[model samples]
Target: MSKWMMIILIRNREFSKDMNGLVLFCISVFVFITCNCDEEETLEGANTCIIEEKYFVSKKVVELWPMRTKSHVFCWKVPPRCTKYYIKMVPFEVEKKFPEFRNVNGCCDGYKKVGDKCEPECLKRCVNGKCTGPGECKCNLGYSGTSCDEVCAVGKWGIDCKEDCECNNAACDPISGVCKCPPGRIGKNCEIKCPRGKYGEGCLNDCLCKNEARCHPESGQCICRAGYTGTICDTPCQFGHYGEQCALECHCSNGLGCDPVSGACACPPGFTGLYCEKRCEPGRYGEHCKKFCNCHNNATCNNVNGLCICPSGYIGEKCEQICPGWSYGDNCLQTCDCNGSYCNHITGKCNCPKYWIGEKCDQKVCPDGYYGPDCNQLCHCEQTNHEANKETSVAVASSFCHKHKHKQTRSVEIKILTKEERLIFQYVKDGDYKTLANKCAQGVNMNIADINDNYQTPLHLAAKKGCVFTLLTLLGCGVNINAEDSDGNTPLHIAVADNQSHICTSLLYNEANPFIYNKSMKNAYQLAMDSEDNGIKYIFQTNRLQWYQKIRKLKKDEKKLFLYVRKGYYGSVGDLCMKGVNVLVANVEDKENTAFHFAALYAQNIVPMVFTLLNCGGDINARNVEGNTPLHFAVMVGHVDATSILLQYGANPFIENNDGMTAHNLALESSDPSLRAIFNEPLLSWYLN
Candidate 1:
């Protein structure tokens, strides 16, 4: 056979050695593998341990084994596994003493390292630099690595697979020996994160849903809200505000409060009650029906308006304010002796006297319409206007123009006028008494003087006022309404002179000529037109008045209404009085007289609804009895609403007293502004004012 064929044929037989010898070799390998896998003493029953120490001494080995003799053992003998076995030993009988058989520097050379001359049966643990499988195997519980060179990972508290493997109740794998964590368990040694859909120790607990439901992944169940129905309680109940839990029901009526969280049923502004089913009580309203108000002083309570009606003396909606115009003290129970217009009958807001509050009473907001303290008086125009038109009732025209030109600077004079050429000069030069001017216009009359000063009469003054009434009055007396003045300007000219629109309406409604013009070639209607002042333009372009009734009222009716009111003609208040005619518009003054204000000065009780309007919205800081609030007036007069309303809207009862007394102090003070004395504190002051 060839050498390769011969090697193959002997290989199997070589592996199959002597029966006993093969068995022994297999047993050694088995022991070695087992020792390498485990080594702790605590696992002694089944654990393995490998031994690498020399148990037999050289001489003892030789003496013990005398079976083999005269055979030389040739082997490589660095240490352990690299030795060959041969038979050689000294016979025990050859020794001198039978006890000396164990002692000797000799040994039976059975095994020898391969390629070496000789090797003893006993050898070191390793050959060359290699220790085949020497030393104890495993590291201690806290230690690990190659040949026990490394420590174990944290929290692992264990020895080998045979020892205490401290894995948290999780069964470790058989092969790899790592923790095979159950469902939901994770981490190295199964000590970390839980599974995706499971939670709670070993994922034992399931989730629940009530009415309204939402699913939770970890627990594989539902979260529920009120009035719902479903496996997860995710469905809401029919027409009910809830989920499967069925916890909540709708809580509301027509319109009322709503649940803060669920946004169930919201309430309206004023009404508050269970389900919002009820309206507010007579005087009680708002949330829970808590806030209450009453009228005090002379104020009258308005149920519908929830306000206190201030009487004349009590000038506030609550009637808690003193009369505005001039009255003060005790709900305006007292009035200052110095008078013109009086305090408001509701709020005690001050109403300064005419020529005091300026034009429109809104002059404070007027750009140039008014000036000075209290914003009283119209802006005066240039004197040149007066001088230029001197001979033609110039002073009146100039004064009118000056006052009207509050907003802008517009020159209307034909030529620059000198002060020397003023109205006085014309008056002085002509000195014509009741004499028709050089040009007798259609409305002029040449007659002797018999009327008022200058033979001009009140009509002349009215003419000076540049109103339609003046010309009409002259016309009624057969004096031409179109009469020309010494400056050759007619009544029509005077009426449109300053572009006073109201004059155009008045004159046109009467008999003043609309076509009449001056040397400037501008007619009355043209003069009425405005390029700047929109208000003036509207007056010129729009309707003059509401109707004939209004016009007549503006003229003849003012007197009638006044007479009726003064005479106390009992009727609808409107039927008997007018704002400027009989009574001023609420708190406004009329001709500097305040009868309505005086009437409120003597009240017994007050209303509330009216009081708040006058107090908060109206002016209530008027002074009658040394500047007292309407509270003083109502207290003196016993008006209930006045007091309640004032307090509700934040009226200050501790306000300073005009003469060192407050409204409360004034109650302690004297009865009237003129008659009251002064005191230091409110109580003392109350006795004085």
Candidate 2:
């Protein structure tokens, strides 16, 4: 058996004629060998003549076959018989010149010669390694497998991944086996955790936790402290809850809540104890009892404000002084009932004269039946019918006087105001008409008085203070128009005395009795006349004329409507309007002004009155005697509410009064900014312009 070599050649026209003969002879040899061989059977120890492969063709073959067709040519290493025949057939001289005709050696396609023997080869290169054999690779360190394409698996390193990685919680260098600590780990073996407030790879990231919270070493996740919960631990626990993540419930009592962080109870004013369950101890008041009490003489101290409550036989805020002038008991409200001046202020016991006896010392030696200082003994005595009747009549008269004295003292004494009365007086004194009106609407007695304050009723107080709105509110509440005070003075008298001309006018308009005399035997009109001030007197005169005119000009229904409107009696006004009373008719008493005109004059019930009049088809711009519209009168009086209502209902502010002044002109002349502000509204701005 013999291994044989195959060679291929082709003819080219570019070759000279002498070379062409050699090409033709080689071609004839190639065809002869192929024709002599069996088509399908293998020849033992014999190579096929057709060696057409797509690899490594010699450069010389390409040069010789330049411009040759794409079809392949074949050559074979013929057997000895064929070679002998071919040598005999070809010229000996040509065979001697072409030495390649003897033998040619080469690997098949996709192979290169290394030494003597040809081996199988790979055409494409291997990555991370060298090609050592056919489709085989020799990989470098840290790489393995057929093509050396795979890196070492985790915890492995070195050639073919033969060495194990010596690292903890880290990545290992594939070739060096050096430890690479992951986020939040350090040290040579990656066994150490990152320092506090540091996280992430190499501990380079700062922790985002707040409020003394901790963060995860690796993930930077926040761990909140007690009483805090949030992504960054910035939020405090909600109310009624405390402790870590707000998971704990609070058990505090009588307080808003416990401290959000420590769950400690926080007490309010006048309270103490762990859970604020106790009030301030006696004589110690206010927050935590930090303040000292100023009370004296066995007075009770208030727990909240440290106010002193005076006991019996005591007077003054701190009970520092004893009741004087035969007065005793709580707040010195009790009087000594005794025949003698001397008495125990604490017990109200009379120090009877030598012959006098009994609690009040009314008995002269116990009269006929009773005896002893207390008159607790009984004694027999003879008496006639006339004597008995006389004694009985005398006793009855004494009893009556005693009861009358008590009643009179009680009526005039300074009284502690009730809660409702206190509030009512405060409202009246402050001239808070809105609150007072609300209280009146809630069924409060509008005529209530503080006897401590001269028994002045709300009306008297309002008149004295010259609170027009308050006075109007009281008047409209159906209080006694002429209620007498302790001084026997009426509200009219008070108003006249105080020189409140407007209040006097209001009182007179409400039919307050000007003729009724006070304790000084002076009537309201006389009081006004007595005053040095003429304004009050003028108000009275003018009010009286108006009253007379109002009575004469208005029909019964018109009178009722006018009175209702003046008194802010909207219900009555509504009733009258429903009865078809002419709301447009002008009243002579009100300067020939319509009901709407009076509404502008008086601010009380002005809103409802204006609405009522307008709803009844009253002419909103009706001109009074002075050519002054309702808008004109409203601005003239500087009535903000009235003016605003008129303007809102589309009152023509451009209408000229008799003085050639529009409502806007009147507002500009007035000192009230509210009136000008109403005129300057965007909706009314155009009218003024």
Candidate 3:
């Protein structure tokens, strides 16, 4: 509508004119309003929003990032001119609860579906345990199975240990990684079983032992047996018999004894002896001939009584010896000359005396290089060729009797077998000929002429060969390890001479008698010591380890505790101590100490100490128990510090007993830090005074 017309109509106030102007104005206003509404709708329909693009990285693939297209639900209004824009929303494992957005722009580049002519960058992935793209997946270690679809099996837990559990002896529960124990049992692996006569978590009950009997902890039973009774079956019958079977009895009275358990008479009432031999009289033995005889002569005719009698050669109350050499001879008739008695009364046989030569004459002779029936066996050794180790002529000398080393000839079958090659040595088997190397003089029965002692045993031959394996094999076959060679040297000695450590090792491994010294007085260890090669010595050293290994299994408790160090520390684990632990030291310097004294003196505490001694149950107050306590030691070192602790534990500060010194005296005498500190202790001032 025209402003002028509207104003003029209003000024004139003419009703007809004003109505006409109003209708015209209304038509114009209607057209303008319709046009503006159309424009606003067109602007809104522009259809471009500030595109928000989020890209998530895959944990599985890691390289590719998947994009999510979502626009901001609430955004800052845009200017009328603004049409298109971009906002990059980086997809992260931890998503943004709220993101800032604004109306802006557009873009043609968006993540297109796969197999569509898309680029490699479009393929999404899992980033940080999350899917960045459409088809991304990642599984942890145990879930390695396809798609991490499967998990550990029954009784299985831990990485790949599907069924290995700590229950049922490390049997894992199927669903949860828990353990299961056997029936009538519980705990980690169900290792502990219920004891007999009692059943429960720990077999803790008064009914454990049976019928008023006390049970052994391990055996879990009352000690009642066939002939025994009582809770632990520890007592015996007062009358005599007492044992498991009551097979004994006290027949130890009236010269008799009973079975230790049965109360049966082991010996008759009057008999007294282990086997109950004879009757025991008043003068009898101890408890039964259990009394002793004072007789010197070996002949004692009295039973029950231990009194002895003077036999033929003796005559005295105690029958100590021959009666003053008067000899009770000739039926005590007389003393005879010629050193002999007349003879038997009926036969008249001459009784020759000691050191006599002639038969009835009883003449004497000189000793040593003498000859005759009167101690006359003399230097029959040929004066000719007195030299030893001499070769002799076999022909005429055959008849000649050279007292020493003369050959005795005998017609015997002689056959020589082929020389045999063995792992040990080459042996020449000569048939049926016994050769005596060294012989004694005047050989009669003096020499074992028919002695069948032949080639030494296999052990001897093995020693000769110095073949350790052969030696070991021979020993394994029960060959005497100590068997001597012809030279009288044992394999042990031979092993030394040859310096055969390999053979020695083998021999020692099979218990080659390393300690047995030969006639030469040399043992294997000594031989090893003598050798130029250290290998032999090394073998000896290692042999000790093998020996200890064998015996280690045999011993237990404190004795088996093997203390070692550094390079030579044998069979030791960093933490494990089968045999306890101890330290080898110079004179066990102190009862409660380690070898750390030297190290500590050098101030090498930073050496990263690994206590090989471990907490080997070493005594802290061991000396305290003995009165020369650690407190005393602390004082001795001039360090009274440990004294307080020692005294607190009931260690007597004034206990100047075993070593003759109190902690105060020791502290007063020395200059160790701890002891010095102890001397100044006010509480100990009284003890010091």
All candidates in order of TM-score, best leading: 2, 1, 3
Query: Which model scores highest in lDDT?
Result: 2
lDDT, candidates in the order shown? 0.38, 0.66, 0.40
lDDT of 2 at 355: 49
Question: Candidate 3: which stretches are off by over 4 Å?
Answer: 1-425, 428-456, 468-477, 485-488, 548-689
Model 3 poorest ten-residue lDDT run: 28-37
Ranking by lDDT: 2, 3, 1
Per-model TM-score on C-alpha atoms: 0.20, 0.35, 0.18
Q: List the candidate 2 regions with Cα displacement exceeding 4 Å.
A: 1-168, 172-222, 230-235, 269-272, 279-497, 500-689
* Residue range 349-462, candidate 3, lDDT tens digits: 445544343434344433334433333344344434343221332212112212221122111112222222121123212211111111111211111111123335545545
Following a full C-alpha superposition, what root-mean-square deviation does model 3 have from the true structure? 35.4
